[model samples]
Target: MLLMMAEVLAFSRVSEALPNSTFWQFLSFHQSHVEWVGCSLHDLIQPSFSFLVGVALPFSLGSRLAKGATFGALLRHTMVRSLILILLGIFLRSMHSEQTYFTFEDTLSQIGLGYTFLFLLGFYSPRVQLIALVLILVGYWAAFALFPLPGAGFNYTLAGVTPDWQYNLQGFAAHWNKNTNFAWDFDRWFLNLFPRESTFTNNGGGYSTLSFIPTLGTMILGLFAGKTLKDNVAPNQKIKKFVITGVLLLIGGLVLHLTGVNPIVKRIWTPAWVLFSGGWCFLFLAFFYGVIDVANYKRWSFFLMVIGMNSIAAYVIADGLGAFIGNSLAIHLGQDYNLLFGLPYATLVKGALVLLIEWWILYWMYKNKIFIKI
Candidate 1:
């Protein structure tokens, strides 16, 4: 429920489905991505999901390690899992027909990279992880700042094909990471530079080695958070620490933006964005953690847990089954309802219908204990 609300309602494909109506225009804010170079409530959905994965890492891996899991076991597990995720991301990036699918802009690939980094961070302590986080964020900032684009300073100088931040980098990525579940070669040899391959798309590029830097910060922050939750400290103490940390991150990010060291770009996952987004993640989860674990208010979290439990499944289902039924099927069924509402109210009602239908699918999965982990 919490996760799904974050994903489905987190975006506006549904709103796009009803452009002719004022109602949709009003609700459009909820369903769309941030305009560009700024933040919005909708923008946090993907990073928050990744951050949640980070929060779960300590509990899951620590449990196995406590039971005598070996270092090799952990590494092998992490590698295999990341490979599977890379494949899954490749799959999602290719989900639609060739006409609809492009080389980048898939969320699963981002999640795959995030999980892989989180796996490695699990081997380190919070203090050490914090140092690495700073290095990754600052290191990438400097790297891009020094690396020249064809026609620009420091930023990627992608060909004029698109006005995106990284034109050359994404195409540079597309040449090798084009999707065979593995691309055969850097056949364009001149384009290959970075170890990881990512394609450029108008929406955004996934698989960017550059984006990984701040995203790594997101994971470290999550690890720090996960460790804090394990402490047997008092509730007020926990709240105070998280609140202070969140405030500091928020304040620090704002101050840095003012200095212009970072501009808080979401598409590129800038350092400022990482700090800002992670701070919100900390603040948001702190409240939830305080209530559920600290105050023993487990019942209230149940609604969110419903959506959270089957989160990945819900994402897959939404990607797969959602359009057919809630869209075309509903249109067919609406021979009756459509007569009453027309396109205006009907479109709004359709969004509600789609959401309810998606929730029910989640409800069904929950009842059956059919949780799918990536």
Candidate 2:
């Protein structure tokens, strides 16, 4: 909750500081996903999320390992969790829309699928897991770039494709799930396969299908992180090594770009993108490790740690409450109360109020221990 508040405020502040009407434009830039062939701070969000999943795995699964959980127990746990996440995503996407049709391809769904794969990777040895990550990345790259786009056989370039494949995929997803895509949010193609998410390449399904790869990489890194925390490695040495390694990965990612292998496109999930963002994730881990663990700055991290402790809850609060409050309150206030405040400040005030409302919602959840989980 705290982190969400801070992140949202930082976003709005960045937008506010822009000159002229650039505030709106910059705000859009921050809120909107990046186009193909580039990385943005926004792109970091999903990977960070995936990384968080890995961070939790050891703690959660370690308990299972300790409690004498069998293979059957682990499989059941994985399946149930994935389904819950997937369904939750679909439910969130469809919540306020017309009830005539159902929707698919939500973040929850991706997280569900992604988490299942992440656990599987974490279940294995790090060496094998790393190899799997490489295969997934290289394989997806080949699938999107080398293989022709469906229905455009022998033509691989995703340029000028009308109606994103995601729509078609959702259409299929809706059918399998006994529902239909909302017209406003997606195309109504029937039985569409592989609903696309943000693509690495244009239409490449940004971390969509390809996410399983980097996601595994993210988990692998987390495993190392868990091991670090568990092991007695000197804090100072770990911090130094982490800083140096992160810097090298960042630099190496850049050097690869200079050599013209692939641009650092987040949409396409280029290997370079993985190396770069994954490097930054390492840096983030280092900072938090240094501060919270090494420096013992527990007080400062407490708020984020609260939200981080229930990170998934924060995701719902940050987005779910933001949308629900913003839409309903902004409309009611602007349409009904604008006569008093006038249009100029009425909408702005409503937006601020909505943010406050979301904060309170999260705060309430935190206080009551009413976190919604998968």
lDDT of each: 0.63, 0.58
Evaluated at residue 134, the lDDT of candidate 2 is 73
* Candidate 2 global lDDT: 0.58
Residue 200 displacement (Å), model 1: 6.1
TM-score of 1: 0.79
Which residue pairs in candidate 1 collide? 1-306, 1-307, 11-31, 12-31, 149-157, 158-167, 158-168
Weakest ten-residue segment in model 2 by summed lDDT: 176-185
Tens digits of per-residue lDDT for model 2, 1-374: 34334344344433454445675556546554665545666667765666666767878788888999987789788989988886777667655755412333454565676777777766787688768767866664444344322343523343323444332323212211111112211222321333434322232233233344445565566665665555567999888777876788788778766666545655434566767777787788799889988898889765565566566777777666775666776476565652355543444455556666765666677888877665
**Reference-based lDDT, residue 360, model 2:** 63
- Cα-based lDDT at residue 317, candidate 1: 71
RMSD of each: 6.4, 7.8
Stretches > 4 Å off in candidate 1: 1-27, 99-105, 149-209, 335-342
> How badly does each model clash, as a count of residue pairs?
7, 13
